[model samples]
Target: MPSFTVVTTAQRYEAIVETGALARLSEFLPSPAAKVFVVTTEDVWQLHGSTVASALSGRSWHRLLFPGGEARKRLSSVEALAEEMVSLGGDRSSIVVAFGGGIVNDLGGFLAAIFMRGVPVVQVPTTLLAQVDAAVGGKTGANLTSGKNLVGAFHQPLVVLTDPSVLHTLPEREYRAGLFEVIKHGIIASEPLFRLMQLERPSVLARDPAAMQQMIAESVRIKSEVVSADEKEGGLRRILNFGHTVGHAFEAETSYTRFLHGEAVGLGMKAAAHLSRLTGRLDAPTCQDILDVVDAYGPFPTLDGIQTENLFARLVNDKKSILGRVHFVLATRIGATEVAAGLAPELIREAIASTLR
Candidate 1:
C-alpha cells in the first residue's frame, strides 16, 4: 500500500491509497476493538458489502444505512445515526467505519465526532471525489439552510483507506466531475499534477490503474500537506476552497438537486479563473489555460435561468466570508495562488457574468 501520514495538533493518521485497500481494513482497525458501526448508503452496501463483510468477518459490527445525497447531509441524519448507534449498544469504545462517498464520509465523521463525545472514525471513501479530497481531510460537517458546511468540527479520522479500483463502479459523469477537485489540488499547489490531468484525460477517463493511482496518490499528498499545516482552515487551508465560493452558490440556487458538487465546482473554477484575470492577479494566457481545463472537464449544466446576481450575493454567506467581505483564492499561475479579500463588486459582477452565462 502507498501511504502518507497526516499530522495535526490533535491527531495523526495514515491515508492509504492502494488497489486492494478494502482487504486491508482489518489491519488498520483499533486493536482489541469493541463494536464497529459501518456507516454507508444502501447502493454502496449492495455493491461492496460482501467484500467488507468478509474483511471484517471476525469483528462485531453493524451496518448503518445512510440515504446518501447532498440533500440528506443534515443534522437530522447525524442525529438519526447517533440514535441508531445508541440503540445498537454503542459507547465511547465503539468505533465508526465511514464507508461510502464524500457525503457519507462527512456525515459519518461528524456523527463519530459527536456520538459519545467523539469516538474514532476510520474513513473508507468509495468515490473518486471522496478518495482524493474529503477522505483525507478531517473537516467533517453537513449542509445548512443558510450555507454549505456551516456546522462542522475538526475531528480527525483514525485512518483513511482509498481504493482507486472502486472508482470503476462510479457513473461516467460523476467520475469525471470529481476530477475538478483533483484539478483543484493541482492548481493550488502542483503544476505537474495539473498537467497530468490536462495531458492524461484519456487514461484517467479510462480508469487506467496507473493513471488513477498516480492521480489519487499525488492528490492525497497535497491534501495531507495542507491539512497537516492547518487542520482548522484558519489560514493556509483557505486556499483549498479555491473554487468553492461561487461553486457553492450554484449548489444553493439549484437546491443541491441539479448538479453534483464537483459539477458546480467546475463552474466555480471558470468564474474564479476569470476573476483572477479580471483582478490582474493572473495573466490572460494563464487564465485561459485554467479556463480551458475547466471547460474541457465540462459541458457543465447550463447556468441559464440561474441568476448571476443571486450567485454573487450568495458569496457573503460563504464560510470564508468575514463580516461581509468574501475572501477568494485567486490563481497567480498554475500550481500557485494568492488569497484576496474585499474584491471589488464591479469585478465580482463581471466574473460571475462571464462564466455563469
Candidate 2:
C-alpha cells in the first residue's frame, strides 16, 4: 500500500491508495468505537455493501442511505441522517465511514462534524473525483439553493481509504468526469503530471491498474502537500480552486442537473485559461495547451441552455469571492498558478462566454 500522512495544526491522518484497501477497514477504526455509521447512497451501498459487511463482520455497525444526486446534497440530508444516527444510539464514540463519491463524502463528513458536536470520520471515497479531490481535504459541506458548498466545515477525517479497483464498475461518464480533477491537480502543481496525463491519455482513460494507482497517489500527494501547508485555503491552498469559481456557477445556474461537478470544472478550466490569457498573465501557447487537454478529456455536456449572463453573474456567489469581488485562480504556466482578485466583470464575463461558444 502507498500511503502518506497529512499533517495539520490540530491533527494528522493517513491517505491510503491501493487496489484492495477496503477489505482491511477493520484495521483503521479507532478503539472502543461505540458504533460505526456508514453514510452512503443506495446505488453505492448496493454495489459494495457486502464487502463492507464482511470487513466489519463483528462490529456494531449501521447503514444510512441517501438517494444519490447533487439535488440531495443539502443540509436537510445531513440533519435527517444525524437524526437517524441518534435514534440508533449514535454518540460521540460513533465514527462515520463516508463510503461513496464526492457528495456523500461532503455530506457524511459534515454529518460527522456536527453530530454530537463532532466525531471521527473515515473517508472511503469510491469515485475518482472524491478519491483525489473531495476525500482528502477535510473541506466538507452541503449546498444552499443560491450556490454550491455554501454551508460546510473544516473537520478533518480520521483517515482516507481510496480503492481504485471499485472504479471498474463506475459508469463511464462518471469515471471520465472524475479525471478532470486529476487534471486540475496537474494544472495546480506539476507540469510533468500534466504532460503525462496528456501523453498517456489512452491508458489513463482506459483505467489501467498501474497507471490509475500511480495517478491517484501522486494527485493525493499534491493535495496533501497543499492542505498541510494551508489547511483553510488562505494562501497557497487557494490555487486548488483553479477552475471552480466559474465551475460552481455552472452547477448553480443549471440547478445542479446540467453537468457533473468535474464536467463543469472541465469547462471552467477552459474559461480560466481564457481569462488567464485575456488578463495577460498567461501566454497564448500555454493557455491553448490548457484548453486543449481539458477538451481532450472531455466532451462535456453542452452549454446549450445555460444562460451566459446568469452563468457569468453566478461567479459573485462563489466562496472564493471577497466582499462581492470575484477571485480567480489563474494558471501562470502549466504547473503554477496565481490568485487574482477584483478582475473586471466584463473580462470575467468574456472568459465565461468564450466557453459557451
Candidate 3:
C-alpha cells in the first residue's frame, strides 16, 4: 500500500507500489466503465494475464495483445489497437489498462489519449524500467521512422499500479537494463541513492524485495517531483532527458534492435560524462565516478561499426533539437546536470568517439 501522488496543473494522480498490488486493481478502477481494455503483449498475457483476469472477474473486460518489442511501436499499431477497441464497443467511457513494460505503457497511453477523443488509462507496469520511469510520466506516443516519440501527446493516466512481484519473472538482462534509469535518477538528484547502488549493487540485482521497493519508491518520487513541476518538458523537466539526446540517436541509427532503451541510455551517459569533462563542466574524478557506475551495469552493447557522423545525423533529428541547435544534457557532476545549447556537431562527435572506443 505504499503510494504517492503526482500533482500537475491539470490533475493529480496516485501511483501505488507494493508486492501483490495487482490484486487491488479494482480499488483503483472503482467506477464502472463501458468496457475495460487490457492492452499488453502475447507473452506477457500468457504469463500474468490470468492473475489480472481473476482480479477483474467481476468487471466487463477484454484483452488486446500487440506485437512485443520496439519494432511494433508505431502509428500502425496504435491505429490497429484503436480499431480493435471500437470493434469491442469501446467509447469515451472505456478504460485502457496498459499492462506491460514501457512499450505497452507508451502505446496504451497514446491509445487512451486518442480513442473516442480521449479516454482514461491506468498503467500497470511489469518491468523495472516502466515502474520507475515510463509508467509515472504522462508522456505517451508511437515512434516514427524519423525519430523516437516524434508523434505523441502529453496525456496523463488515471493511475499507475506497480507490483514489484512481477519483476521476478523478468530476464536478468532486462532487469539490468531497467537499473540504468534508477542509476540516472541517482545521478540527477540523489547522491545517497547513487551511493546506495554502489554499496548494494548485488542485492538490488538479486531483486531483494525490500531493496527493490525502496529503490522504486525513491526513483518514482524524484520523477514525480520533476514531472509535477514541468509537465510538458518546458524547462526543468529537460534534465530528465540526461542521457536521452544521444541515446535516442543510437536507437534510431541501430533501428532499435541492437540495444534496449535503457542500455542505449547507459552508453549515452558515458558519452555525456566524457563531454562534461572535455568542456570542464565536471572534474576528472567525478567523470570517472559516473563512468564507474555505468561500467558496473555493463558489458554494454558496443558501437563498433556505427559511425559518429551517422550518430550525429540522428542526434540532430531528435525532437529536442530545434533550429539546428541541440539541447544536449551534460552532467555537471554526480547528482546534477545542465543543458548545453548550441553545441557544435564536432564536439558531440568527439565525445561519441571517445566513449564508444
Cα misplacement distance, residue 154 of candidate 1 (Å): 1.7
Off by over 4 Å in 1: none
- lDDT for each residue of candidate 1 in 1-357, tens digit (9 for 90 to 100): 699999998898999999989987888888656899999999999988888999898898999999998778999999999999999999999989999999999999999999989999999999999998998879899988776687989889999999898888998888987899999999999999999988988898889999999999999999999999988888998889999889888887898878888988888888899999999999999888888888887777766789878988888887668888898889999999999998899999899999865
> Which of 1 and 3 is ahead in TM-score?
1
Residue 80 CA displacement from its true place in model 2, Å: 2.7
List runs of model 2 lying over 4 Å from the truth: 305-308, 344-346
What is the total number of backbone clashes in candidate 2?
0
Which 10-residue window in model 1 sums to the lowest lDDT? 295-304
**TM-score of candidate 1 to 2 decimals:** 0.95
For 1-357, candidate 2 gives per-residue lDDT tens digits of 799789898679999999989889989998745699999888888888788989998899999988878778999999999999999999999999999999999999999999989999999999999999999989999988876688999989999999999888899899988889999999989887899788899999899998899789989999999999998888998898888988989877887788988998999899999999999999999998888899998888877888779987787767668898888899999998999987887888899889888
Model 3: residues >4 Å from true position, as ranges? 344-347
The lowest-lDDT stretch of 10 consecutive residues in candidate 2 is: 312-321
In angstroms, what RMSD does candidate 2 have relative to the true structure? 1.9
- Please list the C-alpha lDDT of all candidates, in the order they appear: 0.90, 0.90, 0.87
- For all predicted structures, in order, the TM-scores are 0.95, 0.94, 0.94
The 10 consecutive residues of candidate 3 with the worst lDDT sum are 26-35
